[model samples]
Target: MFKRILSGLLLAAAVHGLTITKPASADSKLHEADVKWQTVVNNGDLMPTAACQADAANCRTFNSYNQPSLNAKKRVVFRARSKGGKGGEPVHGVYTKDMSQAGPIVRVLDRDTEVPQPNNLSAVFIEPPSFPRIDSVTDMIATRGNHKPVWEYTLADGSDTKVGTTGIYTNPFGPLITGASKLGAVNEFAFFEVPEFPGTPFDVFPGSPAVTQGSTIVFKGNYTVNQIGKTGVYYRDLKNQSLMGAAGGGEKAAVLIANNTHTLIPGTQTVFGSTAPPSAAKRQAVFAGFDNEENPSLGGIYLAQLKPYPISKQPMLKTLVSIGSQVPEEPKDTRFNRLGEGVSFDGRYVAFWGAWGDENKIVRLYCPKEGNKDRSAYCMSAASGSSQDAVGWYQDKSVPINQGLFLHDINTGETVRIARTVTDFSDFVYWNFSGRSPGAGEGEEGDEDGEFARWRSASFLAVSSQIKRSKDDTPYQVAFKARTGALDTNNTYQNPVDGIYLKNRSEKSPFATLIQTGMDGTAFDPKAVFVDEDTGVSVVLPVTEMGLERDGFRNGRLAINASMGTEEAGWAGIYLGEFR
Candidate 1:
């Protein structure tokens, strides 16, 4: 399907000549190959810079306007002239260097330029692929006989030197360089082709060459010729290293690879593979739903149960709940309906909650098993018509209810109000608060105002402001830990920066706070909250504005946001924290 879509798009463009400026066949060929010589140059845009004039005084030009560095040294030094007035310039030039021959200095004319002429001259480096913001510059050195001339540069500390020469030489990845040279005194510059790996192409997707638990692996393979009909996800086992499961019909769909102990619903499209769970209790779980139509509808979440005996047999899938629909008696005053959903640590309960249009409408539901007939749903609201949202779970027993907190007993199907009504929760405002039952273990400690401190055995909570005070309205973030009701209402933590917030387990003074300010338009948002079971240290994973929207430490190494860079949409990644 991907190939067909790409082919159709390309064929339509070819037939209609849809582009505004059509290039010659030769130019098209060059563009396809990224060939530099075939690029059309606009004479009006060409202006000589100081580096092009050979005068150091004139070269005080802004580095942006200088000929781009094509080598590693990042030194910009090259000039070229063309016969045709509007013709493109050749990216090569000659330079003179004095070398030590015995004790005497010898002035030698050299071809120090290392640009990939004609083939890659049209290439522009907005940022080095590996190093962002660093520009590669152009430089030339002397050629010795048939061998490319080598240029030497001293390190920044001046204690070490590195040498690079012109002519084709294999680079760090074994790419043959058509031309090359050294840049400045500290940088190494070279232009080389991307080498094709031999043998079974090293699978870039399944980076480790084997499938394992907790790995978001990608399977990549190359064919000498393109296969038209064969496409979809295929898997191989680590022990046998043999093809196991194959799901067809969709492009870019994900296979939730889990052990055999996991369950699935019946009649759902899924591919089964042979792999025993770590224990007799564990099963592999995979998410395999595809919507191909342009306006295809979203399917509800499904639970699949895997059987160990027949590895090729499809798993059993049980429909849990639909995200597209709202509860039947949902209040109309609330702008949004559903809040958030997650499974319990024991995977025995799937909990969900959301705010109705009105402040008085708060609903919570629990699905205990795949198709339990006795399961039921419930709603909770504040008497003052205050809005509510669920944050997360406190322990295996209680789940965090927004606006007002509630305690529930899963075994008895009973719930009891744990805290007083949150009076200050408004649309634009948020209040930070923490609460715990009287006999809970030592709470995670933190500062009183939720600024900083560690709680020993408590839980922390934060709330946003309801009102918009100014154009740059500072979002109020308050935190507190208490044994019963809300924390100190007067000392709410407020900051214009969105990232920083406070956490506490009990109403007692907080031990520490988490705060982060945006730099250069980058802001962070806290994602997950973790309270140390032993030390009372509260850890959080916050989403940064950079590459990984969600990042946090757990144990020590960072965990990837499974939703990141995957076909699954709208899933924010999860981050774990380290002990230290």
Candidate 2:
């Protein structure tokens, strides 16, 4: 598994000039290869910022960190947001950094911490609204707790646990069969009162919670029960910490795999009108639903398998890539019109995010000159303006989107298309705010407090079908993040190269830009120091954002969240890389 976790590590040869800086920069052949680049916490790096409890903002450092994850002993964990906190309320945390230790970045929960359980019922944490999951082999973290459910912890015995809960779960561990009362009310981490529909509770938990390597806890439960609402996809084994689903507690704590009443729609009998939110490995799980709900393009991408527990029947789903089918290299029948709730499983490779035809292309949406109504003043006077003047003047004409990046080999069904959007990418997806939706407020398009507009996209494909290359066994390997297009320069769409790539189907070299972003920031932190935080002058910047998620890859290591190309304020943070 992952090469026996690096069985006797000491292997390097795959170096191909990509300069982490020292002269070397003609794009360092596209920047970075033998790897080894570490800096897991940047943006000035001081620490402990999150205020709201009062008195804690001398204006520290770190103000952003993204999804991150990684395990197999390189331990990374992420989801941050700090930077000077005088109780103006934006601390938010979930840190952990130990790329094999020199230590110090720890905090597994913040926003004021404190949520031990319902016992004294004091409840504390109010900020982890998503993205946090570690445990590739027990680094244990699984998050989701803006105020009440899915949590796991145990970063060396800080021991948290509330594996999945919501409304009424009195079983802090006491009775079940014989007499039922240490104070009763069992259903162990009940996830909003689910006990096979007894009184009905599932009020909402629409995804973000998938921690497998034996600690199980895959989730996606939803609302309404007697009034009907439906929507499901669950699993809760918490590896012996409790809620193993029903033996002595006899109330069915979790196990429901797929529910839109009864799960169908594999090839297409239809039924599940809503699913998404899943991604487990080795014990199987992989999702993205919609069975019509009046045509969500028909929806696809399945796979279930998962058996164990007192459960029986119902689990074998399979599908893989659906929405109308066909779509392989495209141009003949070109099917798959769309499919992306997210999927990135690595049990045997899945990495999804598809789209096939008809969105009418035409994207020219660049920006970097806030304030002063200038429509790029004639492409910034035919490219003579330079100073980071990216203004391209919004031309999305209200709607038209396209995306691609696929790879599915469940063994051999084969799918492969890794990167697209005008071909090889002009952005394979990135959205902290894309307008008209997410939380849109000001002129009121959306995304302010409605949160969730942040995206690195396509669930951040990180595939690994056993990562072989054992000299040509070449099974697979992938890592992604795009923005390149115009056929990689020569056709130049202006600024068309922002990377983080690596592809190795045994490497004939179709991909390997290990993180290029306008090049030279010490090739990516040799000693870094790219000022201009306000013309303190010495500038270089480059990296305009890069985050990767599918747990940010493992064993060969990857964890990133770059950013630099600043509006000012200490570049940006978190980096790791490794892979030799």
Candidate 3:
């Protein structure tokens, strides 16, 4: 319980209408702690031009980076692009750095790298997906490889060969297609087939795959059989070395956690219409599912056990929260309106995003068309003229969103509200650069695929069971990224300050702002600096963008994909902040 003095001071601050209130104690270690920051990579640094010939288009300096994933070993893996490579275009690939080793960034796999076996041997990788994940305990990385499909066929004698036209190519793998059939197979692929449902190979791995300790990989598999498409969340253990190829090996076959067809929507009479990618820790996984495939309005986050693969019955899903359930901390009649696609589970606790009530607002981004050659100048000028939104000629279609962050204790079945829109948070469904980059154009394009949009609600919450402050009482901690709301304030940015925050199960304040948009870059890096290209003026830029996902937060350290206001493109890179 908070002391009476602290409560009075906070009430006074609230009466004064201050957005943020700090603990007024000279020796208050409970409220906040110092964070040790380390830089991972930034733009303008010589990008590792591996696999590409030395004489290739000077594929030297990095241009941009996507959200990064950090593992327990202090290893960081992310997707980055370097322009002027080979064809005067951007060269992209998955790159990693072992912070424990303090070594240079190493290219794990790139566009120029060959697509491994089970696919066309001669084919090279196309654009690798964003947010490649690292295992909690190993160096293995799981990413979707985009490449030409390797067709398979059954000959007259009923033997399968690489000659059919099914073209089921793009799949997620651990860079190397095969490895020892044991835990921590860093070289094996995440390939699997359901024996009961043959002919429907896992053709596509949607979103980034989640790899738990011991190398158990969980991912959403999209496949079709007899022209009927179905999607499900499945997991495969790499311990069985013999089940390497596309067929099942009895108990070694991939276990289906949940799917659209047979998986029932808890507390409802309907079956699941679709399921989202899962977040796994140990042998347990948690994910979101909807009851309607096309326009889902029901369903919630679910938990599934992953061990004892050859079970006698289907795995039972434990519902964390659902549509008809009462919203936590709200009026009795307030029910959940929608759940997000992203969820984080670490066996004990589940962190997720939920929206309720009818109060909604339109989140609009300046999204210009990509192929509008004739209207490019007009669009550019219109975009440049607006400082409120991204530079673009037209605003992207507005999204009516009302979302919040929540944490549910699996042990107690208690759902606690972390923050809500217009109160604790300004926005949860939309995010953007604090300021534009000189060469970084549109924040998002109108025609761009919404699957990878930075503004999705899925980017809001990330939970880790390892950040518990006290072993006696505290259970877990969660890190959430959002634009500042009524409860947060930054001196530098008059607009809602974007930040990544930390909250525990037993925090007096709702959360502690670990890092935010307007903080000094030096806190993250000692040598961090920014120079104006035109006047050669140099200054320390403030923090801008921060990574928003579970992979960014693990153990007690947070992997941040932050930027220092765009004054220097190189200022934008990955950083690690460890709370002490």
Candidate-wise lDDT, in order: 0.22, 0.57, 0.61
Q: Pick the candidate with the highest TM-score.
A: 3
Ranking of all candidate structures by their lDDT, best first: 3, 2, 1
Using Cα atoms with residue i matched to residue i, what is each candidate's TM-score against the true structure?
Answer: 0.24, 0.34, 0.76
lDDT of 3 by residue, 375-459 (tens): 3333444444432333333333333346688888888899988777655666666534222223422211211211222222345
Model 1, C-alpha of 323: deviation from truth (Å): 3.5
Cα lDDT tens digits, model 1, 1-580, are 4444334433433443322132222111111111111101111123243234575432221111111111222111122222212233222222111111111111121122332321222221111101001111112221111112233345556765323221211111112122211221222121111112111111111000111121111122111213221112222211211111221111111232332222222343432222111100013222222232112133333334433322534344444433243433323432222222111101111222222233342222222212111111111122212233353211111122333222222333332222222332211122212222222221111111111111111122322222133232322222222221222232222222222222122223322222222221101112222234455553332222111100011111111111111111111221211111
Q: For model 2, how big is the CA root-mean-square deviation?
A: 22.3
Give Cα distance to truth, residue 255, candidate 2, Å. Answer: 17
Q: Give the higher-TM-score candidate: 1 or 3.
A: 3
RMSD of each: 28.5, 22.3, 9.9
Candidate 1: deviation at residue 411, Å? 12
Superposed model 3: Cα runs more than 4 Å off: 1-33, 51-59, 151-175, 178-196, 240-252, 293-297, 310-313, 368-402, 431-457, 468-472, 485-494, 532-536, 567-570
Off by over 4 Å in 1: 1-236, 240-282, 286-298, 306-310, 325-515, 519-580
